[model samples]
Target chain A: DVKVTQSSRYLVKRTGEKVFLECVQDMDHENMFWYRQDPGLGLRLIYFSYDVKMKEKGDIPEGYSVSREKKERFSLILESASTNQTSMYLCASRTGGVETQYFGPGTRLLVL
Target chain B: AQSVTQPDIHITVSEGASLELRCNYSYGATPYLFWYVQSPGQGLQLLLKYFSGDTLVQGIKGFEAEFKRSQSSFNLRKPSVHWSDAAEYFCAVNGGATNKLIFGTGTLLAVQP
Candidate 1:
């Protein structure tokens, strides 16, 4: 089975603080994604990366940015956390550009 | 362009009752369809997927989904409901062979005794 490991399962941060969430996939997938899950909103895409140092904006990417330093690692950054940014963060990766994505256990972020 | 819609926000059913979760998609051509289930505090698990060939596909944990091209639907069904089946279900579609899934707002299922 493929594994995607996230750095943290839960986190708490104060308003205006910077936050980083890390994700590493053992399968060396080419496409990786970051999403925020909220009640009634389901899962909204924050950003996605196809290769090292390459990124694309998703539906709701205003306050978030992502970094793909290596083939197996992708990181999501919240430049300045806010109360509304509190939600479940999910990380996923696919072997190729068009394949079933494998997901990691989500990280719940709370910004007070 | 492609999009997904799951009409039922929440549903409650008896343990032995049959189960069905509706999913509708908007895509011109035959699109890749998927259903995922997320248990409490867990990541999303792929229930089933439909790309081509036979429309009916079976998945893990006794879950199954049928693709109806004419109705633009990929509804999930199970013969008997289990308490462990309680989870939030999401429907998704990927168009033109791309893996980026356009997701629908999930439907939460609750099993009663």
Candidate 2:
């Protein structure tokens, strides 16, 4: 099984604080993605990295950024933690291309 | 532009009953279709995907989906529903050559005793 692991399963941060959510995959996938999931709206792409240090913005990337310093690790950074940024964050890695993506357990972020 | 839609917000079925989840998509040319399941707080897991070939695709956990080009629909179905089948299901369509995926509002499933 492809194992994608997130650094933290639950996190709490105060407003204006910077938050970091980390993700790692053991499958050596070339593509890594960060997504924020909300009720009714589902999961919206935040950022994605195709290769090391290469990132692209997704549908919702206003206050968030990502880092891919290595092939196995991808990190999501919240510039300033706001109450609205509180949600479940997911990380996924795909081996071949866009077809199949394996996901991590997910991190529940609470920006108070 | 590309998008996905899961019409049923929630569905309840008996443990031994048949299950079906509807998914509709909008995109130009042929689209890559996928169904994923998220159990509770876990991340979404790929259930099955349809890129071409057979319209009906078999997946893990005894699940299957059929794609209809005319209707632009990919519906997931299972013969018998187990209690463990309860989960939130999401439908997604991949558009762009960059691997950006558009997902639908998920459907929550509840299995009755």
Candidate with best lDDT: 2
Q: Kindly state the fnat score of candidate 2.
A: 0.91
TM-score of 1: 0.97
> What are the per-residue Cα lDDT tens digits for candidate 2 across B1-113?
78898999999999999999999999998889999999998989899999999999999899999999999999999999999999999999987777688899999999999
Positional deviation of residue B93's Cα in model 2 after best superposition, in angstroms: 0.8
Q: For residues A32-92, what per-residue lDDT tens digits would candidate 2 score against the true structure?
A: 9999999999999999988899999988999998889999999999999999999999999
Candidate 1 regions exceeding 4 Å error are B96-98
**Candidate 2, superposed: residue stretches over 4 Å from native:** none
DockQ values for all predictions? 0.75, 0.86
Native contacts recovered, each model: 0.68, 0.91
